[model samples]
Target: MEALLGIDLGTTGVKAAIFAAVDGRPLASAFVDYPLFHPRPGWAEQNPADWWQATLKAIRSCLEQGARVGVQPSAVRGIGLSGQMHGIVLLDEAAQVIRPCIIWADQRSEPQCRWMTGQVGAARLIELVSNPALPGFSAPKILWVREHEPELFARVRTVLLPKDYIRYRLTGRMAMEISDAAGTCLLNVAEGNWSSAVLEAIGLDPALLPPVVPADAVAGTITEEVAALTGLLAGTPVAGGGADNACGAVGNGVVRPGLALVSIGTSGVVLAHAEAPHVDRSGPTPRIHTFNHAVPRAWYLMGVTQGAGLSLRWVRDYLGLPERALERWTDLDAYELLTREAEGAPPGCAGLLFLPYLQGERTPHLDAYARGGWIGLTAAHDRRHLIRAVLEGVAFSLKDCFTIITAQGLQLEQVRATGGGAKSPLWRQIIADILGVELAVTNASEGPAFGAALLAGVAAGLYPSVEAACEATVRVVENTAPRPELVTLYARFYEQYRALYPALRTVFHALAGLS
Candidate 1:
């Protein structure tokens, strides 16, 4: 019984899932969490060593579970990796980690972003890399380190993304997959390689970057050392995996045109598959991102909400203390308890609105200084209204993504939903109605990990191609359609939601300054 291993290096944890190579059914999985360090406000960092340790434990536990199901370690034929994008991990000459990885959520590179725009002309930069310089991108983070940590930066011999660093540990190889590389603000999206022009303009050494490879290509084989540690077979092929969103698109079967994916995880993304690169160069800075897809020769346009599930998490931690206490004695989850209460609130939250800009605004706004808060809060509103507003606000922000995709003439015939937040029935209903589209959930519940497994299947010859693997395995098991009355109400509320951002833009910047 041949199986595939998919390892997802997420922001908070690493997950190892074993899947049947023939049909993409998950066999066993294990997750091990690591802490995210924020030494200063607006800065998110993680030790790559933690990721490596957690990954080994997760794989061992997953394989142990698989063994109980009659699968052997040697049964695993291939491995695929998926992870958070835009985070930078620098390795010194001795292959030693020079500093903690600056993750995607870190916002310390605003000045570097300005420097990028000043050096390479904003419009021309977009034309070169198919996206604008954002604080979260790898290039800006690199620049930040170059200036702020010059001593450490000088020793940087190689730069890797979160997952690629894991791959290096597993295989003793260093290469960046194209899909992940595309998010670096250094890759030429249409060409599927590092952009020399962008590198030159930014004064970055191309040599510090790894060779680019296709998502399904065999990047390297697992080393004997890794196999000994994790019970995987020595020389097991490891596919060049992708960024989380790219793999999520593949996992949800959004590989071709006319299909889009809506993922609500720590962050939120509305992505549409495209055969050709689509750049939003109309504005001073492009609103959406055009990145290479996990599927070879394909591209995707993605609109991101910096805080989607993160916003709800804030409420869960701070405001739902009662629910958390109750959870100790009950089987109901704390989030579930909150959502049930939120369901009792009216559709429009009685005119309350939430802006899910807790981290910062992405997609249409592209403002890292923008902060999150509730608008139209009144004495009449309670916790239910606030909770519901968070849900509705996330949906509305995603709608901002959907609206831009359609306006650009991308045909989104179907919307597939994935991620932690998508599991909520209430959130799904809100998103479906707010977007005025039927949201479908596929059987690939493991999200990016499952998608990574499918990519492994292709690399290992279990399937002919990524599309064929999806055609064989992924199917929509549930659908949530928009209710007409709710759709009308959300449409009105969404207009008001749109207005709040622009109105608060100046104030948000001011608040950011004060902080």
Candidate 2:
């Protein structure tokens, strides 16, 4: 009858899951979508209140479903939070939201990132923390507010990451977990707390940040006000969980060193779970990120591709609108419909390469202004060719990241794959062939939400340890291997795909009209 609940505040939605303390199998789960706001061309923001409301709705739905499945709402003992990383949430002295939570994908703080790198010295910064500057990181966003909204900056009291903000609402506690703080670019990763040096250079008071804690530790209990609003017990324990990605890695059982995961969500990422810190100081500008593992004192290395599924979504919603009229003729899904016709697309899209940078790019490019395109489109080809090229281009970009991960000394024997895009057999096959790694896909797609519930089980004394939770719960459903012929074909095409970015790098910037 015992159960633990996990709530994940994701970029696209919020998910709540209830898991049995006995075996860690998820008993029931629910998710609800919320709106995203883009005030300017490059700015992406969300209301903190909306995230809290969406989380509560998702949790209530889960509690209802759990009761239907024989686990009553009161059986939910301990709860943990998993949320998107690098978001800046500020509160005044009275603990009121001072601004919209600057989300992880927003690119409005490029100048702040450059300034921090210059002031802190990038090498010293990386040595102090495990990662380098990204425009979306929390510290850079904080600096952005100071430089742009100075009046509001003067009133700031406490700064919180996305899940930290949620936890603040739930338990009236200002605290953060190490894995979430790692993405903030303000944490001393080795010390597992805020870096005073970075704080001083950035001109922010160290006291403004929350006290850091380990992911498994309990931060506080739910307040009476939250209990009345959420319909849960007033004294329910709230654990500090990691960011969505780290918790997702935990959810998928990538707790031990040597295991890697391929997540093709709105953005794409290839992460390897490492026991010790993994840093490559020598080459490649070192954009690969490292964060403390959600599993007690562990670490992980990850490579990212920013324009994975979004590119396909863009193409389908924009360029392929005519293809839907084509959709009425067949039962195939848009991807299947496109893939069938596009596979007929010759290798390299018959010289039609796409950059896949619809929303800028990350990993190899790291260029926010990096625009996307079809290099050689013609009247001879139609929509399917363009659509397939986007998919292949995304796969090729992911391979570029995987190549870096391999360079950093992580062996790639197998990869555990998850996410919405992972459902497509063709995309999965394409990634397997392009990366040249055997890929295993799991059945449960709840990802970090499921992983958060597992952590809850650990906290509630349901499992001896986090390892035992994954060992008992996570299972692989299918293993995909690269076709020999397609692998050989992609090897040649990948070389060309890698070079295309640099060749057009100047042109991408020029077309920006930035000058």
Error of 2 at 165 (Å): 1.0
lDDT of each: 0.92, 0.81
| Whole-model lDDT, model 1 | 0.92
Candidate 2 structure lDDT: 0.81
- Record all residue pairs in model 1 with backbone atoms less than 3 Å apart, i.e. clashing: none
Model 2 worst lDDT run, 10 consecutive residues: 320-329
Runs in model 1 deviating more than 4 A are 323-329
Badly placed stretches (over 4 Å) of model 2 are 282-284, 320-347, 513-515
For model 1, residues 53-89, the per-residue Cα lDDT tens digits are 9999999999999999999988998999999999999
TM-score of each: 0.98, 0.94
Quote model 2's TM-score: 0.94
